[model samples]
Target: MSTNLTSETAAPTRVALVTGGSGGIGRAVVERLARDGFALGVHYSGNKAKADETVAAIVAGGGRAIAIGGDVAEERDMSAAFDAVEAEFGGIDVVVNTAGIMILSPIATMDLDELDRMLRTNVRGTFVVSQQAARRVRSGGAIVNFSTSVTRTQFPSYGGYVASKAAVESMTLILARELRGKDVTVNAVAPGPTATPLFLTGKDDVAIAGLAQAVPLQRLGQPTDIAETVAFLAGSARWINGQVIFTNGGLA
Candidate 1:
């Protein structure tokens, strides 16, 4: 009898490892990818509870997910995290670098220490995770990084945060060029005035409303808004590589 190879036997499940998967936008990306039918690695920095919660929700929705935690800026931590996902999910097809920190201060008045802290997380963390992803992500996969729309807006008090993400944008573009012929796409998503815990932490109602009004769409971006762009980049958008997509609602 001839052996019949079904499509299931020929193709394995696609896998995604999302850094900061427990946070607002990160969780949305994780859930969106899970619904897109990829097995997920929900990575957290220190909050295992949130990580586990994300995983549980994915599971409840009949999706496959596992919690992985580590400092994204540490090469060793990220290496181990990648190892764990590979062991659990076979291979990673997409690596999403959504783990980052933001500290707002005017350049002249900002504390250097706070700037350093933001850089360590936003820049070093991205570099470390990208290093692992460059080495590990399977062919025909994608590596998505995060930048910020403030880079374009030139907003005050965002000097530190914008500097870090500027590095990310530069690095992302170079990496995409370097990955040429690898069949792996690399890009960064720049979101503006998103209503996340990170964005809403210090801003009062007036400041928030002003930001929303600045957008031509007249609303603060939801996590899902950013996640939709990510979902497109991660699963399809084969032609859209080496570019930063501004996910803001016409913030200029």
Candidate 2:
């Protein structure tokens, strides 16, 4: 579909570009933002099919959305993705960077390549996208980056992942400060063990149950839970800047 947008026409709505929007948590965010009346730019790295599905769903629901594809870690690709959204929707108002990867391995035995890949996607990707958002997002816009609860939990097999997320947390705080007089909010969401394909791929039922039980709520977090947090950040939660909101059911 054409997204029914163009640069020549003045934008009549707030626009949001959600990276990794074809995935579980990302999809939830997209749907929620659509409901909130933001024109959606659903971004995916390698899965056009999933991206199209997300866009179709939004369109079917009488919302505006278009699928955008690009490598989050590549500056040019990410730039193009942002440009496409702006070209279509007039300008970007909110950016939620949920594009990330997780490969669990202990510190000592972890593959260097895996660590690099994770850092590239989670760290560099956030940085690149954040850079663009900082430059392009309109005043009163919000930038929400994704982090993981493993950084606080200090899990053994999550050393590399935790390290990557720690960088995200740091960057989020610094970016918020850097945007001193911009009136834009920059924050990070640290989700704790949400029941997404990314988080559920390797664990057994028993292990999953154990994790769920460990949480104070005695249940795994749903994508919608995190999505609600994001929607809040992307909307009127202006004072909640430079903070990492953990949406993990009180799972510290």
Candidate 3:
């Protein structure tokens, strides 16, 4: 749970820093990257125990990983986390900004503090992490940012949250253009109504079932489904840059 890492440097592998690795989609991405033989930095904000659990899962599966605690919203913490990755794994090859916040409310009644937190964590945090990743990630490496399908659905009570993700989508496009000659790819994955804890909260079973049925796929998306898309973007998907790959199973 502490920042003190387990000092058993394994053989060299692709280095990845996955912000919010303790959560559902993030955990899936971490496991997939580990399976791809990457040395992962499991970044977490508060749930160090969950992050450590993620790391253990990878290590137990013959993969190497380390858990680091830091606030993704703070530039200092973002940079420090990247620095840790560089120090631990020589240099970062991939950065996935899956850290985000979803506080839903109508714009008329939304609290400014909640809005600020969403913007700070989901928008500013992504920019801070991606900006650093843009500069430090090795050429031929990739940067994957998380966006939501709500940006397409335009649902009620999700105004602020959708706005933040929209910013991520836009920023990712421009970032890909800016990282043109670096051989680094920038893209966003916009998942729709995934069956993560973040998506299940505050909803009854019936409501959740109805929500799942609304999707054309006829079921809520699993984290692995999204992780598979991320894996493709990370490896061997060269020339597929600057695009938002919507992994929503035809929902979007």
Candidate achieving higher TM-score, 1 or 3 = 1
Query: Compared with the true structure, what per-residue lDDT tens digits does model 1 show for residues 120-203?
Result: 999999999999999999999999999999999999999889989999999999999999999999999999999999999989
lDDT of 3 by residue, 81-110 (tens): 998888988999899989998998999999
lDDT of 2 by residue, 48-136 (tens): 99999999999999999999999998989989999999999999999999999999888999999989999999999999999999999
How many pairs of residues in model 3 come into backbone collision? 0
As for lDDT, the candidate ahead, 2 or 3, is 2
Model 3: lDDT to the true structure: 0.91
How many collisions per candidate?
0, 0, 0
Q: List the residue pairs that clash in candidate 1.
A: none
lDDT of 1 at 7: 89
